[model samples]
Target: MPWFQLVANGDATDPNDYNAVGGPSCSGPNHICAIQASPNTNNKPIITTPLRNEMITALNTNSSSTNVQLRTNP
Candidate 1:
């Protein structure tokens, strides 16, 4: 799944400040899930508008002092 990792100064090798965002699964269709919502119907996960907004807020808040990196894999 795609994920976002927050690291200190955008340095992933630091191993000090690391926060991951993305890991939620739903069994049914059209179900609203949090963050990385994985549904059973398709490979592409549906990201609700509210969830997307929240993520953007979080990224903006943390990005001021740290670096947010969007990673495609675990």
Candidate 2:
């Protein structure tokens, strides 16, 4: 298995270098997951949002739009 890191930026609110409070550090969880409740976070408007998804998809050779698919499926 591969490893990942969440370097802190001296901010305590953001995800610690180990996913303590928030995640990967950022302005905030001001996206859908924390607001709209759309369940469409796979493409969250944040960087780390799509980063992990894409990485996993690349390693598994799967489409990264799984959320999009779920939205269109019956």
Reference-based lDDT, each prediction: 0.36, 0.27
lDDT at 63, model 2 = 29
TM-scores, one per candidate: 0.33, 0.21
Q: Backbone clashes per model, in order? A: 0, 1
Q: TM-score for candidate 1, please give it.
A: 0.33
Model 1: per-residue Cα lDDT over 1-74, one tens digit each: 44333332533222223333564332322212233333324333344566456556644553211122233222
RMSD of each: 13.9, 13.7
Give the alpha carbon lDDT tens digit for every residue of 1-74 in model 2: 11222233432113222222222222322221111112223322233555445444433542223321111111
Which pairs clash in model 1? none
In candidate 1, stretches whose alpha carbon ends up further than 4 angstroms from where it belongs are 1-34, 38-40, 63-74
Residue-level lDDT for 33 in candidate 1: 22
Regions of model 2 farther than 4 Å from truth: 1-47, 62-74
Among the numbered candidates, top lDDT falls to 1
